[model samples]
Target: MPKQITRAYEERLLRIRIMSHTGDKIHIKLPLDFVKRMVKNNALDFLSGKDDIMDSQKLLNLLINAFDYNLTGEIAYLERNNGDIIRLIID
Candidate 1:
């Protein structure tokens, strides 16, 4: 049998932001459960680019582990030379 992991005391949210040099910005907030469901249903297929591929299973595992480990805060941040920014946060 596989070992079961304990869930965190509180639920978390995933926050994503995309900003363009032209002052355009997009922000998205999703509950963890919704993200897990989306990953299971392959609804995040757009995450893969022409030459880059993201494994759904791996992404699911990461999400599971995030809660298991009680991880919170910014997990990814990127800034381009053109002054655009992207950020991924677990809160």
Candidate 2:
């Protein structure tokens, strides 16, 4: 890691930016080496459906999954429960 990348730059660099008509903005970023590992683990398909910003649930899941945490149990539980699950998902 020669010439270390500053936190600000590193943070911005991971973002996946997109521009849209009607003055809408969309930003997506993942941690360093996220895609590489997911690729190696054969989980890159999870990155799909990201371009569809209209799918709020999908977008929320992708953002949380970015952290590589274990939320499978919670996810399964939510499948049984109801009400704007995004709160529980993100929490």
Candidate 3:
């Protein structure tokens, strides 16, 4: 039988900056483990395609729409489980 796995405490990771040509910038911080999981799950593959690439503007708009209300001026910690999760601290 497989052993049971438990969720560990979430930790802070890296911050990504989204800059626009109008000199506006939005900062988003994500957990390291979460990012690794995303890569492993090919969550970012759409952005890496050469032929049918996702538009940068559309991606940015989606991000902003999803995280606009969660913006923070400073870094913050979030509670998360070991299951697939994506938490963003946008500013």
lDDT of 1 by residue, 1-91 (tens): 9764444544668887989899999999888878768877878664444543445356556666775686877776767677878687788
Model 3 vs truth, CA RMSD: 16.1
Which wins on TM-score, candidate 2 or candidate 3? 3
Deviation of model 3 at 5, angstroms:
30
Q: Give the root-mean-square deviation of each candidate in angstroms.
A: 8.4, 14.8, 16.1
lDDT of 3: 0.44
lDDT of 2 by residue, 1-91 (tens): 6663345323322444444434445555555456436555657453334443354446445544643552222231121122211212211
**Cα-based lDDT for every prediction:** 0.70, 0.39, 0.44
Give all TM-scores, in the order shown.
0.63, 0.30, 0.37
Clashes per candidate, residues 3 or more apart or on different chains = 0, 0, 0
Supply candidate 2's per-residue lDDT for 57: 45
What local lDDT score does residue 34 receive in model 1, on the 0 to 100 scale? 84
If the candidates were sorted by their lDDT against the true structure, best first, what order would they fall in? 1, 3, 2
lDDT of 3 at 67: 39
